[model samples]
Target chain A: MMKYYFSTEKMSVGYHGQPLIENIEIALDKGEILTLVGPNGAGKSTVLKSIARQLSLIGGTVCLDGKDVEKMSGTQLSQNMAVVLTEKLRTELMTCEDVAASGRYPYTGRFGILSDADRLAVREVMELVRVTDLKDQDFTRISDGQRQRVMLARALCQAPQILILDEPTSYLDVRYKLEFLSLLQELCRKKGLTVIMSLHELEFAARISDKILCLNGKYMERFGSPEEIFTPGYLSHLFSIETGSYDEENGTMELEPAGGEPKVFVIAGGGTGRNVYRRLQRQGIPFVTGILFSNDLDYPVARALAAEVIEAEAFEPITQTCLERAKKRLVECERVICCKDSFGTFDRANEELLAYAKHIKPQLIVQTNFEVIELDQKEQNKSQEQKDHDKFNSVTQKSKVENQNQTHNVRKEGIAPINQKR
Target chain B: MQHRRKMRYTAAFLLLGIGVLAAVALNVCIGTVEIPLADILSSLRGQTIQNERILWDIRLPRTLAALILGGALALAGYLLQTFFHNPIAGPFVLGISSGAKMAVALVMVFLMGRAVRVSSTAMIAAAFLGAMLSMGFVLVMSRKVEQMSMLIVSGVMIGYICSAITELVVTFASDAQIVNLHNWSRGSFSGMTWEQVQVMAGVVAVTSAVVFLLSKPLGAYQLGEAYARNMGVNIRLLRALLVVLSSFLSACIVAFAGPVSFVGIAVPHLVKSLLGTAKPILMIPACFLGGSVFCLFCDLLSRILFAPTELSISTVTAIFGAPVVLWVMIRRRQERTA
Candidate 1:
C-alpha cells in the first residue's frame, strides 16, 4: 500500500471533553498544502490543536508516516512537526535570534546549549524567512508582520517534515499575507514539507491550497480539491453569505445588486460596461444592460449586478429578437447609457439600437464616460457660479434634516438602521 | 554584532563578580566593632587575634548566610518569573516566602513546646511543604485569572493570611522562645552559626546547580508555553520542576534566615537589566551573583546604619528594593501603551 505522509482517522476534537467536530478524515502527501476554510468558531483551531497535541483528542488517531501520533514521545513528535500558533508571544529581553534559536530545543543537549551546527541551522532558517536583518532586534519590539516572519523562521528552524499553522496571516497586512504564503509554498516545494493551516482568505486558500477542508463547528462539510469544493453556489452557502455573491471560477466576490425596477439602461459590450455597472450598483441604482455577447469580458459582472441583461450566443450576431428586447428596455429606462466606443459588423444591431435610443430619448444618450448633458440651462448656470454658495449650504442643510427624520422614522418602525442605511 | 554581544556578557559577569567580592569584604569588615583590614586578613590566615572570635563566630557566618540565602532567593524569583511569564512574579510577591515562613514557624514552635530540638533538615522540609502549598494556590488563581495584576493581588492576599496565622502562633509562644522567634520572623540573618552556614551553602549550591542545568528548558519557556511545547519541552514536567525548584530555593532561605522581603523579586530584575539580556544561561549565574551582592549590601546596612541596634533585613531590603518594583510596574505600563 502507498503510504500517505499524514492522515487522520475518525478524529474527534473539542474542549473539555465535549466533541465539537467529530469523525474528521484527512490524507495528504509530501509537498502538499492543506487549508481549512470555515466560518469563525468552526473548530478549525480545535482540530489543529488536537493534531498538534496542544489539546487532548476526543477520539481516534492522527497518523504521521503511518505511525499513530499518540504513541510517539513528545520529543519525537516535535522533531517531526512544528506549529505556529495564534497566541501572542510576549517575552522579556529576548532578541529575535534567541527566539529563533529556541527552535533547536529538540536537538540540543542536556543544558540545551546550542552547538555550532545548531547555530548554523538557526542562521539558515532566519535567512530562509528573510529575517536575518532583524536578528538582534527584540522580539516584542518588532512589527506584527516582522514578528510573524520571525515566528515562521523559528518554526523552520525545527526542520520538521510537517508544519502546522493556525491563522498565520490573521494579523498581517495584504503584502505580508501574500509574502508569507508564497514563502510557505516555496518551502513546500524545495523541502517537500507538508503544510496544514487554517486560512480566512478564501481566494488565497483556493489559489494556494492543494486541498481544502470546510468545517461548520459541528462537522466537516466538505473536503476535496479546491476545484471540487469551490463550486459557484457552494462557498456562498457554506459561509452563509446572504448579502454578497461569490464567483467560484475567478474566486472573486460581489455585493448583492440593488433591488428595484431597472432605473438605467446600459448599452455596453466588450468589457466597457463593467465599471459603469459597478458605479451604478454602488450608488444603489438598479440598471439593465443589454446586447452583450455571451462571452463578453464584462458578462460575469453584468450577470451579477444588472437587473436585466440581453445576451446573444458567443460569436453570434445580435438576434432580431434580442435587439427588440433591448429597444423595449431602452424605452422603459429614463436614460440610456451607451458604453461602446465603436461597433464591429457583428454588433451592427447594437449601433442601430443606439440610433433608436438617440431618436426616442435624444437628450438621454450619454457616452460610456457617464457625463450627462445639461438639460436645464438655468439650473446649470446656478451650479456653475461661485455666488451660489449660500444657496448650496441651505439645500445641503435641508437634505441633512430630511435624512435625519427619515432615519428616525425607520427606527420607529423597528427596522434596524444598519439595513436601512445600506 | 556577535562579538559585541559576547564582550558585553563577559564585561557584565566580570563587573558582577567584582561587585560580589567587594560587598562580601565590606560586610565582613564593617560592624559595630570594626576590625582593621590587616587583622581581618590575618584572621583569615587562621591566626588567633583579638578579633578572632568576633570575626569567626559572628561576622563570617552572617556574611556567608547573606550571600548563600540571597543567591537562593534571586534564583527562586527567576524560576517563578519564568514559570508564570510575569516579570513581577517572585517568592515574596507570590507569598511563597511567607508560606515557607509559616511552615518553619509552626515547626519551630511545635518542636520547642515538645522540648525537642528541630533539625535543620526537618525545618527545610516543612518550609518546602508550605512553599508548595502557596504555589498551588497561586497556580490555581493564575488559571482562574489571566490578568497578571490580579494574580499578584491574590498572592498578596495569601501572604497576609499566612502572616496572620504565624502572628497568632508567635503571640502564644513562651517568653523564653519569643525573642528568638520574633527576631527570626522579623527576617534577619543574625545568629547564623558556622554549622548553619555550612548547611545553607550546601543547599544553595546543589539547588543553584540544578537551576543552571535547567537553563535550556527555562530559555525555551521564556517564549511562553505554546512555543516552548513546540520546541519539544514537556510542559507538565517543566512546570512541575519549576514549582519544586523554586519552592526548594525559597524554603531554604526561609528555613535559614526567615522571610526576607523583595530580594526574590528585585534582584533578578536588576541582574537582567545589568546584563541587558534574559538568556537563562547567563541570567542564572548573573542573578545568583547579583542577589549575593544585593543581600550583602542590605545586610551590611542593617548592621551598621543604626549600629548595634540593627534593623530587620526586610526593612533594609524594602528601602532599596521596593523602588525597583515600582519602576518595573511603571515601565510595564509604558510598554503596554506603547
Candidate 2:
C-alpha cells in the first residue's frame, strides 16, 4: 500500500489574535475526499486557507507527508500542495489554457518557463475538465460554471499531492452544482489526491464526500460519513430554524413556511401570471383565474402549467359565455388576482367578470384599474368613446404598483416566502 | 503547429515594424530643428552635416532615451501588476519614483545647492538610491502583510509621506535649482547625451532580460501568493528579487527621463489587450516593446501637438492614458454585472 498521509495533531488557526477554528484534527489516507460542511460564516474557508498556508496558524503544526508545512520553502510547499478558492479569478484577457499553464510556475526554471512536461500537465487537466474546446476562450468572458471548472483545471495542473478548495459549489446552479462536485470526486479517486473542500450544499456533501466535517454552533462536529452529520437534529440546530426536514436520499432541507395560507384568486393576462400561480402551488393552496384573453401568455401558461383558470376572449373581451364558465369556477376560489394588464384597456365583459368576483366577495387582484374597465364597458355597450394613453397609464400602472407592495403582505399571509438559498 | 508558429512570427514582425516606424517618427519629428526623415536618413548615410549636430547630437539621443524609458517603464508596470495582482499597480505604487525623486531632490537642495552642476550620471545614481530605498521598505512590508490589498495600502502611505518630504525639499530650493528639478520631475529627454542613453539602455536591457527569464514564476503570481508557493515557487525570495529588479528599471528611467507617467501603468494593459492574453511570457515582451512604442508616440505627440512649446511627456501620457484606464474601469464594472 502507498504510504498514508495525515495531519499529525489537533491544530488551532487564528488571525490577528483571534482564533478562527480551534482544536480541529483531521487526517486522511490517500484518495480521501474530505468535505467541510457548515452554515454561512462557519470558517470552513479559514481552515482550508490556513492549511494551504494562505493564513498562518495561530497555534499547532500542520504536517504534510510527515513534514512540517511551515518548515518547507515556498517552492517546496507549492510542489506538495495546491489550492482552488471560492473567490472568482480576477484576471482578465488570459485564455483557459494560459491560466492552467500558470500552475507549472513553481516547477519551472528561474524564469518560470514551462517545460514539455508542464505543457502536458496543463493540456491533460483541461481535457479532464471537458474544457478542451474552451481553452482558447477568454476566461473572464466565460460563464461562471465554466470559470469554476477552469479554476479546477488550473489547480490540478500544479500537480500538488494535496488540493484545497473553498465552497466550490456556492455560485453554481443545481445542474452545474452536481457536475462540479462529481468532477472533484473523480479527481480525488483517479489521482489518489488527498482532497479537502468546503461546501454549503448539505445533500451533495453527504452524497459525495468520503468524510464530512461540520463547523456549526461554535463547535467542530466531525463525522465519519454524511449520514452521521446530516441528521435532522444536527441541521435544525445548526440553522437556528424552528422546523426543517433533512431529506437524506436527496440531501435537501425542506423548510416549514412561517405563516398560515392566504386565500387568493388570480385574474391575469399575459405571462405576468406565472409567478403567482407557482407560489400558490408550492404553498399547497388552490386558485382560480379567468376571462383570460385567449392570446394572453398567462392563459396558455396557466393551462399548460398549474392552477385552475377559466378563459373567455381569444382576441377580444371576456364574453358572457366565458364569465358564466369562470363564475362556476369562482364559486370555489377564495380570492381573485389580476396580473398587471398587458394592455391597459379591458372589454365590457372583463368588467363584468371583475364585478362577478366582487359580487362573490372574493378579494380582487386587478392587473389594471377601473378606467380601462370603464372603456371596456362602453365598448360592450357599443358607444363611441375614447381614452387617452395617459388615462390608461394611470388606471393600469398605478394600482399595479400598489399590488406589487401587496405581494409582501401576501407573503405575511405565508403563501410562499422568497427563496433565499439562491 | 507549424502554421501557428508561422503566424506568431508574422505577428511579431508586424509589432517590430510598428515599433521601428514609431521610433523613426519620434526621432525625425522632434527637437528644435525638427529634421525631416529624409534628412535624418541622409545624415545616417553621412550626407547632411548641416543638420548632423541637431540629429546626431540631440535628436538621436532623445529618441533612444524614449525607447529605453518606454520599454523599461512598461516592463516595470507589467511586473508590478502581476506582483500585486492589481492592474492599477505600477512602479510608482510603492512610491519608488517619488522616492527616487526625493533622492535627487535632496542632492539638489543640499549637495548641489542652486548650482545646477551635478552630472547626469550623479543624478541617475541619486535617483537609483532613492528608488531602491523605497523598494526596500515595500519588500519588508510584503513579508509582514499577508494580503496584497494591505501591502498596496502601505505602499500608498509610503508614497504619500515621500511626496510630503519632497514638497518640503522644494520649498527651500533656489529658483535655478528648482527649474532644473521641475524639468527633470516633469520628464524631459531634451539634453540627453549618448553617454546617458547608453547607461539607461544598459540598465533597461539587462533588467528586461532578467524579468523575461522570471516571466514563468511571475505568471504563477497571478494565481496568488499562496498558490504560487504551493507550486514550488520560492515566492518570498522571487517577489523580493523581482521588486528589486523592477525598482532598478524604474529608477534608471527616472534618473534619465524624469518620472514619465502612464508608460508604466497603462502600457501593460494596452499590451495585454493587444496580445489578448496576460501570459507573462508574452506579456513581458509585449509590455517592453509596447511601452517603448507608447512612450515614443507620446514623445512625438508632445513635440507636434503644439509646435514650438512642448508639453511634458507625463502630461501627454495622462491625456491618452486616463481614457484607457476609464475604459478598463467601465469594462470591469460591466463584467461584474454580467
Candidate 3:
C-alpha cells in the first residue's frame, strides 16, 4: 500500500491463463533487498519471473518508480531493471568479459557496440565482484562458484535501478556465497541499488535480506522483515518438514530426535552436550539430557535430538524443585553420562546433578573430550586403597563402547603401515 | 583479449572478401566458353569481344544470381538460428525452401499451361506464402519439442514432405515444361536473367539492412528469451521481425534459384567459427559474405566438375555443407556432455 521504488499491485501470474498465485503485494524501497523463501514448487520462481517481466502477468500490474511495468518501452524498462536468471545461460565463443559487457545492452548503441565508457563500466563491475581475473576465460569453462560471480558481475554492470535474481547463491560455495551476498549488500547500501531475489539458503537469507516474503500455496503467506517472518514453527509448516525440526531464529535445521527413550541420562550444560546428544541420536540410543536452562547454548540441540530435555528458566539458579525433578528422571535411566568434567558458578546445577547420579549408583560414566570414564562400583568400594585412583594407564583413553568392535591395527605411532600412497 | 577479437574480425572479413572475389572471377571466366579476365573486363566496358555475349548474358547473370541468392540464404539462416536459439536451423534444413519450391512449381505449371508469363514479383509472393506455411509448421514443432535436435528432425521431415509434393506437381507438367521444372527443382544457377538478379539484389539489400538494424536486439536474444526480455528487448516484436525478414530473404532466393541447399546452414556456422564470436553486429555482414563465397564456389564447381553435363547447385553445396552440419551437431553433443 505504501509507495516504494518498486511495487507489485494485486499481480496474478501463472501458466496458460491459470492463476497459480494471485494478489501478490510486495513493496521495496530504494537500497533494499527483498528475498522470496518457500518450499520447492511453491511458485517462488513464477512470482520472480513475473516480476522481471520474463513471464506475462496474468492480472493486475507491476509498478517500477510509479510507472506501469508492462507499459514501459523496452529501453525504458531495461535501463531500470536487470535480472540474473536460473536458466542455464547457453552461450558459445563468449568470454566472461563479453557476458559482462552484454549487461550494458540497454545503454549500448544500435548494434550493441560498447564505447570506452561502457567498457570501463564492465571492467569496474567485474572488479567489484572480484572476477576480473576470469574476464578472458570462456564462461562455460569456469567452476560454478566462479560462474556465479561472473553472472553477478554481468547483472551489476547493467547499472540498473533494480536487480532481480533467482536462486543466485545456489551454485556458489560457502566462501563465495558470503562474498556474493556481501557485495550485493554493499551495492544496496552504497549505490542505493534495489535487489529482489529468491534464496534457497535460509541462513544466508535471514542474515542478508532487508525484507523476506514467505510463499506457500496459492499466495504470499507472510511478508515482513526476516525477524517477523522467521518465527517458530513457520518454516517447518511452510516447507512441510515432517521428520526434522527447524530453529527459526537461527535458521538451522535438525533431524528428528530418537523416540521411546530412557536408556541413558546425560548431564550436559554450557555447550558441552551438543556433540554427545547428536552422537546418541545417530546411534539411536534415545537418551534424556538436561536440566539445561532455556537460554543454554545446547538447549536447542537437546530439544531437537533428546528424548526428554529437563529445562530450567534462563538465568535462574539451581532450585530444589528442579533438581528433584531431574533426580526423578535420572533414576529411570540405565546409566548416566556427564558431558562436562567441570562446572562453574553458572552451571553449578549440572555439577550437583552429576554428583547425585553417582550417589544413586546405578551405572555412571564421566564424559570428556573424546574420553568416556566408566566406574566399576563394587571393585572401587572393595579396594579404594589398592585401586588408589582406578587410574591404570591404558595409553589411549579409547571410547571403545561407542566404537563398533575393531581390532587395534597400530604398529608405531598408530600407523597401519601401508607401502604406497596409491 | 578484446584486441585479439578485433583482429579476428578483421581477418575473417578479409578472408571472406578475397574468397568472394576469387569465386566471382572464377565463375565469370571458367564457363563452357572460357572467357579470359581481360576480355571479360572489356566485355563489361561494352567492347564486344568474341565471347562477350556468353560472358554477359549467361555467365555474368548466373554468377551475380549465385552471389545475391547465396547471401540472402545465409542471412535467412542466421536470422532463423537467432530466433530458435539453435545453430542448425536454416531455410533448406527447415523445409522452408522446399515449401517455396513447391509453390513456385505450382505457379509455373499453372501459368505455363495457360500460356501466361509469371513475373519475378509474383513468383516471390508465391514463394513467401509457401515459406511461411513451412515456417508455421516448424514454429509449432519448436514449441512442441524443446530439444534442439527434435526441431531439426521435424524441419527435415517437413522438407521431405514438401519435396514429395513438388515432385508430384512436376509429374503433371508437359514434356517441355518438365525440363524447365526439373532443372529448377534440382536447384541450379543456370538460366538466371539480369532482371531476376536485380530484383533479388533489391530484396536482399532491404532485408539485410533491416536485419543489421536489428543486430542489437538479436545479440540480446542470443542469451535466451528470458534475459533478452529482461534487457528490454521486445521479444515478441523481435521474434516476428526475425521470422518475416528471414522468410522474405529465403522467399527471394527460392523465387529465383529454386531451393539451393545447405548454404543457409553452412555459411553462418562457418562465419561464426571464423570470427570466433556470435555477436550479431559482426556476424550479419560476415554471414552474408560467407554465403556469397560459399555459393559462388559451389555454383562454379557445378559448372566445371562434370564439364559438358552441369551438376545441380544443391549437389555441390551438399557435398561441402552436410559435413559442416554433421560437425556442428557432433560438437554440440560433445560440449553438452562436457
Candidate 4:
C-alpha cells in the first residue's frame, strides 16, 4: 500500500454543522495537483476552506505529513499550508509588495516586522510570480490577472508545503487563466508543493490536475486520476447536462444538437465540414452529416451537431451499404453541402456520395466553393463604386438605419456572416 | 522608492512633533494672563513667575489631560476603523463615546446626590461599561448591515439616543451639580485636577502600550478577517481585543473630557493620508501624535479664541474636524462613482 503524503479520510464539510458533502476521501503525494471540479453551489469552496482550517470540518480527520490538522497549532498549520481564497482582500493603501510581505506573518517576530530573510523570501516569490515590477503599485489598482498573481506570490511567500486555493482562476481572463495554471504546475513540480484548488473550468482541471475530484449535490461523485475521472459521458451524467454534449476526451462542451427532423445533409470528412456543422447547429437547422470514418477528424463534431450521422468503420473500405445509406439520406434533405474540394485516397466515399446526390437532384447541390472568388470580387466592386459615389458627394439610395435593420435580419435569419456569400 | 517612503514617514513624524511642541508652547504662554515665553521657561526652571498660578494650576493640568485624552480618542478611532474596515468608524461617530458619556453622567448624578466624591477610576469604569454596551450594539448592527453608510447612520442614531439620555440625567440633577454636569456634557478639557490627570495617564498609558504590542495582529486584521486568520492571527481574539482596547481608550476620553467630536474619525484618517501608508506599526504611533497635535491646537483655540467666554473643546474640534470627515465621505463617493 502506498503511504499518502497528505490525505483526508472520510472527511465531511459544510456550514454551521449541516454537512453539505460527506465522506470525502482524498489522497495525494508530495508534488501532485488535486483539483475539485463541480457545478455552481457544489461546495467546492467549502471543502477548500475546511482543508485550510477556515471552516471546521464536520467529520473525519485531515492528516498532513502524518500529523492530524486539528492537533496542529495555528502557527504550525500556517507554516505548512497557505491558502488563496476567492474573497477579495480589502486593503487600505497597501502596496503589492506590502501585501506579499504579509505572508511572512508566521515567520516574523513581534510586531510582524519582516527580517532580512523574510524580505528575501518575499522578493523571491514576487519574482517567481513575475510581479517584481508591480511591487510599488497599489494592490487594489492592479488588473484582476495581476491581482491573482500577487495573491499567489503572497501565498508562495509562506514557503508552504501544501497550497490550497479556492477558485483561484475565476477572476482571470483566458490568457491569464492558461498562464496561471501553467505557473501553478511549474510551482508544484519545482517545489514539490502539494496543491489542492477548486476550478470551474473543466478543461483546465482535466489538463493540469494530477488527480480530479468530482462533486455534485451532496457527495463526492468520484475521485481518481484525471484519466479515470474524465471518462466518456461522466461529466454530462455528473452535471446532468440536458442540452449540449460534452466530449470527455476533448474536454470541451458543444452546442446542443439542432432538434427536429433532418433538413440539411452535410457531406463531411477530413475536418472540412467542422465549420458548416457548427453553423448549422447555430442556425438550429436539424442536419444529417457524414459518411465519415470513425477515425475521421470531423467524426466527433458531426456526431455532436447532426441529427443523424451515417457512418463507416475506421481504416476500412467504403462499403456499398454505407454509400447507399448516404444516398438515401442525401436525397431526403432539401440541400446538400459538400465541404471538401479535391478528392484523395480516403475521399473516394465522399466523392461518390456527392456524385450520387448530383444525379438525383442537381438543384440541391448549392455549390459554393468554386464561385466564392467571383462573389467576393463582385462585393468588393460594389463597395468601391459606393465609395467613389460618396467621394463625388452623391447621396445613398437607402437609409442607413434600414440597411442596418436588413443586416440584423440577415443575422437573425442565420445566414453565414463571413466568407459564405457564394 | 523605499527610501522616499521612509523619508516621507520621517518628515511626517517631524512635522507632527514640531506642531505638538509649538502647540504646547502656545497653550502654555498665550493665555488670558500673558506671561512672556521667558517667564514661562523660568517658571519651568523652578522660579515662580507673574502668572505661575494661571500656568501651573489652570493651564498645565488641563493641557496634559487634553493631550492624553486626545491621543486615546484617535487611537480608539483607528482600532474601530481597522475593525470595521471603514475609515469613518470612530468612537464619537459610532456613539461609543456618547454611551460612555451617558454612563458617566448617570454615575455622577447618583454620586453627587449622595454628596459622594466621584474618583476618576469610578468614572472611567462606568464609562467603560457604557462604551462596551454601545460597541456591542454596533458590532451586532455591523453584522446585519453590509453598507458602510448604513452603519454610520445607525451609529448616529445611537449617539443621539445616548446624548438625550445624558441630558435627561443632567436635568434631574440640582443646580450646583448642574454646572459641572453641563460643562462635562458639553464636552470640554476644563477643570482638570493633577490627581485626575495621573489616573488618565496611567489608564491611557497602559492601554496604548497594549495596543502598540498588538500592532502585528492588527496589521494582519486590516486586510480583512479571513486573510488575518490564514496568517496565524487569531481573528476572534484580535477582534475582541480591538473592541476592548478601543472602548477603554474612548471611555478614558469620555470619563475625563466627555465626547470630543470628530477627532476619533478625522485624526487617524489625516495621519494615514499624510504618511501615505496604513502600516499599523507606523499608523498607531502617527495617529496618536496626530491626535495630540490636533487636540492641543483645538484646545488652545477653544481657550484663546473666545477668551473669557470659553467655547467648548467639541465646538472647536467640530469646526475643524467635521470638514475632514466630509472630505473623506466625498472622496469615497467619488471613488465609488468613478
Give the winner by TM-score: 4
Model 4: residues >4 Å from true position, as ranges?
A371-422, B336-338
Q: Write the per-residue lDDT of candidate 4 for residues A174-243, one digit (tens) a residue.
A: 9999999999999998999999999988999999999999989699999999999989899999888899
1 or 4, which is superior by TM-score?
4
Give one digit per residue, the lDDT tens place, for model 2 in A1-422: 44448573567776785887788877778888888877788888788888888877878888888899988887777777878886556566667787787777667776666678888888888999888988888777888888888888888887888888888888889889989888887877888888889877777777888788878736587656776776646765665656534544445444342232233556666566656665655554445666677667665445533345577656665566777877676544434555443345555555566677665543333333321111123222221122233246677455444443455455444322322211
TM-score of chain A of 3: 0.87
Residues B1-338, candidate 3, lDDT per residue (tens digit)? 77777888899999999999999999998967888899877877878798767887899899999998898899999899888888888999899999888889999999999989999999999999999999999999988998988998999999999999998988878999999999988888899998998898888899999999999888888988888887888888998988899999998989888888889888898898899988889999999999999999999899899999999999999999999999998998898788
Among these predictions, the greatest DockQ belongs to 3
Mark the 10 consecutive residues where model 2 chain A has the least summed lDDT: A371-380
Give the proportion of true interface contacts each model preserves, from 0 to 1: 0.67, 0.74, 0.88, 0.70
Per-residue lDDT tens digits for candidate 4, residues B1-338, read 87899899999999998988887788877778876889888988999778778888888898888888889889999999998988799999999999999999999999999999999999999999999999999999999999988998899899999999988988888999999999988889989999999999999999999999999998888887778888888888888889999999999999999889999999998998999999989999899989999999999899888788889999999999999999998987886675
Alpha carbon lDDT at B331, candidate 3? 91
| Predicted candidate 1 versus true structure: per-residue lDDT over A204-224, tens digit per residue | 999999999999888999999
Docking class of 4: medium
Segments of candidate 2 deviating more than 4 angstroms:
A1-3, A63-76, A115-117, A217-219, A227-232, A237-252, A256-422, B1-10, B21-56, B91-99, B114-122, B128-172, B301-309
TM-score of each: 0.91, 0.70, 0.91, 0.93
- Model 4: TM-score, first chain: 0.88
Q: Write the per-residue lDDT of candidate 3 for residues A81-145, one digit (tens) a residue.
A: 88889897768799999998888998887777899999999999988888999988999899888
Model 4: lDDT of residue A117: 94
